[model samples]
Target chain A: MIKATNLTKQYDNGFVAVDSLNLQVNKGDIYGFLGPNGAGKTTTIRMLNGLIEPSDGSVTIEEKEVKSENALVSKLIGVLPESHGYYNWMTGREYLKLFAELYGVDKKRIKSRVEEVLEWVGMAGKADILIGQYSRGMRQRIGIAKTIVHEPSIIFLDEPTLGLDPQGQKDIQSIITRLNQEQNVTVFITSHLLKEISEICNRVAIVKQGKLLEEGYLDELIKGYRLVLRNENPTLEDIFFSLTTDEVGGSI
Target chain B: MSSLIKKEIREHVFSRKGVWIFFAISILFSGLTYSFISVKELSLLAQVEVNMTFMKALIGISILVSIILGSTMVSGEREQGTLESLLLTPLSKVKIILSKVVGILVFWLIISVISIPYFYALTYGTNMLLTILSYLYLIGLPLVISFSLLSLAFSTWISSSKNATLLSIVLFLVTAIPMFLSTTMKKSGFAHLVDLLSPVSASMLTLKDWLVNRLGFFFIFMDSLPVLCFLAISIICLFYASKKMDFLGGE
Candidate 1:
């Protein structure tokens, strides 16, 4: 579980990336964070993951402070950065094993765990190939595999499906679904694909200009939006455009 | 921590570039040693002086290699987009910096090992091997490590590896100014001040005292104090820079 209170990040140039934002991600929930470009989504993720210090307020993971380098907080959460990079020299299996060791997986279990995560992300067959030679989809799968190598309770995936083909996108979406439904792992994913989020995420939060526009259960939010628009059926894309657009009347 | 160190070594020191660097240094020492013993005019110098020259060249090359290694350690990771994942792990920033320092140490060790045969080849008939090795480990190691640490601190603060390396090279050349001064310029007040303050000069002075001048241990230790102080300052600067070490790298 994660909680952020009055979180704010303002650059010295007087630009606020995230302004007094608050968010809560419960255990075992697939929470999709949606925002347009430069909407402060990645900044919020970085702050929550403790990769960067917030200019104001704080974040706590399972009641532990997230700002400092707390091993417990690190153990509880895994993160896949938006522009994730890999060591081209390392094979997929070696990469996972290295992360497993860094995450403090038991020495005896590291081998099995690496294999298991490789299999989980559907990278077992290509596990021994150098990352440099792999396709983008394969690299993305390995990236996901690295995050769960140590069995973190929660994983933050920033644009996991970016730059992937339709099949690759589907593969990643299924992996997210399996992780949440079968393994009961919490997923906090960010993306521009509202349709994909609608398919997999049970809860969603939409933000624009560093401020939260909407936050609630997907179905409840949709139902509320449908009533407001006087329409019986409306897609998440419609709701996303409605909330994020600056027009007096939303495009929907 | 060991995993981080191993990763650092594999990524930086155990790669193709690392192998080439080692190979080139080996060839350089071989040629230098052969020229020292066989060249008619050069071979006329005393064996101790030859040994001293070899040691100086070894330390100079070692300092350059260490600087290159340190200058890219952090910024290289940032450029490659690997620093964030490493930071996300439980490893503290200080430990990350320490792991990189260890990687540079491993590089210095390899350079030290490669110079051994050359040292033996030149100091074959004399008791200079022990003295040369002493200077290598004592004055050379500390000075080389200090330069690398100072560069590592620069790498932590600078985002671009190219810029960090360039800045570190400038610093290296500045400290090496005393080495390039003429005998007359060496006696000038400014040169004297730089020689006393610069760690490179201090280490060189310490080595000359022990090897050529054959000064007492107390005098050598006093000469080496500036080098030790430089090492301490570099260590402090590196850790202080590590406190502000971020995923973005630059200030």
Candidate 2:
């Protein structure tokens, strides 16, 4: 479970990325956070995951307030930022082990967790290969594997499927879905692909210009759609586009 | 912090930038020191020669390799994009910076360990053994570590590895200029002022006084004041760097 109350993030240059926004996410939900470029989606995720401090307000994950400098909080959450990079000289397995150790996983379980995570992300075959030799898709998979190597309670993925082929995207989507459905792990995901988000996420929050526009259950929100689009089965895309067109959602 | 330290150590050992040069210097210095001492028949003269040659080798490698290791460690990681993932770990920024500094210092220490044979080959039966130990532990080790820390601080502040390398080399050269000015060029008019600017220059002059002029260990320790001050400054640089660095960018 996660709750953000009046969260605000202001840059030093007087730019407000996220302004006094409130959000709630239930446990075991695949929550998709959607926004256009410069919509403060990554900033919000950074705040929630404790990578950066909020200018004001607070984020509470399962009741504990998230602090940027809290190492214990980091153990419960795993994050793959939108602009992440990996150690090129390290093999995929070694990289995962480094993170697992840093996360304070049991020393004996490190190898097993690495193997399981590599298998989960479909990187078992190339686990020993240097990351410098990996293809972009392989690197993405390895990055995701590192994120879940410690089996954290929550994983935050920002553009997890970015730059991947259609098949790669499908593979990542399946992993997200499987983790939520089978493992009961809470996922906080952000993507520009409304279709993929709709396919996997049961709940979503849309933002534009750093302010929350809409948030609810996919089924409930669709049923409550005020836009009388001709398509009876309007996807999340229609809602997203119409909502983010102006400074705020005017017609949705 | 321990995990980060281990990772850093591995990176230094596996990296090619500084370690090879370190080995070459160690071997070359040892060979030269051994040969220089083997030809001297006079016991007292051989003793002085042993101390002088060993000190030169240790100090030479300390200057070059420390800068090389310090410059390469952080900037290389940042350029390779590993710092981003490193920051995402539970490791604190201070721990990361300290680990990087420690990793390079370990390289300097390894060089020292490898040079032990050279020191023994030259100082086998000499009274200079205590002086050698004292100088290495007090003077040589601190100088190497201070240079390493100085370069690491530069690496942390600068994003470009080339720039960091250039800056670190400049740091090394600053001390060398004073040495060259006072020794090679034999200019003393401003050499005193120049020596005041460099612990290395003061160190060289003090060593010349000790081995060549027969001054005792007290002078060696007393002359190390400048080196100790630089060590303190190196630590302050790390403190300032920890405050200024942004973990996400390593800027």
Best by lDDT: 1
Docking class of 1: high
All candidates: CA RMSD in angstroms?
1.6, 3.8
Model 1 chain A — which ten-residue stretch has the worst lDDT? Answer: A243-252
lDDT of 1 by residue, B1-251 (tens): 99989988997788999999999998898899889878999999988888878888998899998998899989988999998999899888899899999999998998899888888888887888898888889889999999999899999999999999998899989888998998788888989888779888888888888988999999999999999999999999999999888868774
Candidate 2 local lDDT, A129-204, one digit each (tens): 9999998889888988888888888889999999999998999999889888887889999998899999999999
Tens digit of lDDT per residue, candidate 1, span A136-237?
A: 999999999999998888999999999999999999999999999998999999998888999999999998889888999999998999887777888888
Model 2, residue A2: distance off in Å is: 2.5
Query: Deviation in angstroms for B132 in model 1?
Result: 0.9
Error of 1 at A193 (Å): 0.9
Q: Write the per-residue lDDT of candidate 2 for residues B147-209, one digit (tens) a residue.
A: 888888888888877787798888788676775552544456666666676878767766777
C-alpha RMSD (angstroms) for model 1: 1.6
Interface C-alpha RMSD per candidate, 1 decimal: 0.9, 1.9
* Model 2 residue B114 lDDT score: 74
